[model samples]
Target: MFGDLMGMMGKLKETQEKVEATKKRLDTVLIDEQSTDGLLKVTITANRSIKSLKIDDALLEDKEQLEDYLILTLNKAIEKATEINETEIAAVAKDGMPNIPGMDLFK
Candidate 1:
């Protein structure tokens, strides 16, 4: 019983290390997305931090449209960042808990 407990603790430590590594990797991962009309572009890190934004000069004439496109493009970039974050975390979980049966269900 003590051995099993130690093994579980070891696994937990490994999982925590993997999670930390994933977070560091996420800081460097970025997602870029643009509005449907290609007027606005947004770049966000996997940690959901906005790194940069770009807008076409033509869209500057309409403040309302520009705001709308900015919101849309930002949301798209954030969504992609979330997907990448989840995937990386799931991979860490899988790698750290390989001994668990049916663990793929968590992924």
Candidate 2:
């Protein structure tokens, strides 16, 4: 019984390592979003770190419009990044999980 417990513990440790690695990898995964009018463009990592922002000169003419565009575009970018991040992390975690009796019920 102890042997089985030890093996399960080891598997859990391995899964944790894989999950951390996957998170690091996600930092390089980029998600790009642009405003509907194509006036503002944003690039962000799956980790939700902003990589770059490109704005059209037209947007600079109005402060309020620029803020609105920025908010909308950034929100879209964040949403996409969050989805990718969660899916990737979940896939890694689920694949690494060791099969245990009754665990399938949670799925």
Candidate 3:
């Protein structure tokens, strides 16, 4: 029984390393998304932090429109980032990944 438990712990360590490597890969895959009009756009990391934002020169003329576009585009970027994280984490977690406190299980 002790041997089996040790083996499981080793396997868990391997999985944890793999997940860390995967997360490092995600840092390289920045997500960029824009609204339909291209008046606003945002870049984000898989961890859901905004990297940057852009706005069209024309949209600058209307402050209210620019604000609205910023909000809309930001939401789109964040949603896309969430999807990206989920897809990646799910793919790796197919083999009974361990769950630790504060780990982004769903990613």
Question: Highest lDDT, which number?
Answer: 2
Score residue 1 of candidate 2 by CA lDDT: 88
Model 1 scores a TM of 0.87
**Runs with alpha carbons beyond 4 Å of true place in candidate 1:** 98-107
The stretch of ten residues in a row with the least summed lDDT in candidate 1 is: 98-107
lDDT of 3: 0.80
Computed on alpha carbons, the lDDT of every model, listed in order, comes to: 0.87, 0.93, 0.80
State the lDDT of candidate 1 residue by residue for 20-62, as single tens digits.
9899999999888998787888888999999988889999999
1-107: candidate 2 lDDT, tens digit per residue: 89998898999899899999999999999999999889899999999999999999998999999999999999999999999999998888888788888887326
Model 3: pairs clashing at backbone N, Cα or C within 3 Å:
none
Please name the candidate that would achieve the greatest TM-score relative to the true structure.
2
Stretches of candidate 2 exceeding 4 Å from the true structure:
none
TM-score of decoy 3? 0.79
At residue 77, what lDDT does model 3 achieve?
A: 82
